[model samples]
Target: MKGLLLRWLILTLAILAAAYLIDGIAVAGFPSALAAAALLGILNALLRPLLLLLTLPLNILTLGLFTFVINALLLMMVSGVIGGLKIQGFGSALLASLVISLVSWLLTTLVGNEGKMDVIVLQRRDEDHWE
Candidate 1:
């Protein structure tokens, strides 16, 4: 449960970052960003898989690049559903989706699957061995 909340917060931050960086994407405020993130998560959880399965052929043909289109479409749908989040056009949606995906992925890597900051440290125990 804590991990889920952390993940959601990460997503909210990503949305805010996208709005900040993308000219065509607008988020009313933090509350709006939170709501948008939650809706986006729900949609991704429920609808994304179905859409991916339906578009498997095209996805394969495009070497999985078609996933970006699917993500953009979903982002546009989220904008339509959320009153506070606005995407000007398909191009904006595409760019915003890319930004959001990148930010989310980068943050998630730092946070790890358990939603806690993960760190790795290496030490040399001997001349020929490291631990």
Candidate 2:
């Protein structure tokens, strides 16, 4: 549950960052960004897999490049559903999706699956020798 909320927050921040960086993507404010993020999450959860399955041949044909087109389509859908969020066109949606995905990936890597900072633990035993 906490992890889900953290992911949602990360998505919101990613959306805001994309809007900030992209000229054709506009988010009116934080509320809008939050709403857009939620909508995007829901859409990705419900629609993305279906779309991917349906477009498998195309996806394979392009070596998965078509997935980006599917992402742009989802972004366009979100813009249509959310009033305060606006995406100009397919090109803009594609670029914005790329930025948002990159930001989200970076943030999620920092945050572990349980909504906590990710840390690596190592232990050395007497039987283990240094190289």
Best of the candidates, lDDT: 1
Candidate 1 per-residue lDDT, tens place, 23-111, comes to: 99999999999999999999999999999999999999999988989999998999999999999999998888889899999999898
Model 2 agreement with the true structure over 17-114: per-residue lDDT tens digits: 99999999999999999998899999999999999999999999999989889988998999999999999989999998899889999999999777
After superposing candidate 1, which stretches have Cα over 4 Å from the reference?
120-131
lDDT of each: 0.92, 0.92
Candidate number with greatest TM-score:
1
Runs with alpha carbons beyond 4 Å of true place in candidate 2: 119-131
TM-score of predicted structure 1: 0.88
In order of listing, the candidates' clash counts read 0, 0
Q: How do the predictions measure up, each by TM-score?
A: 0.88, 0.87
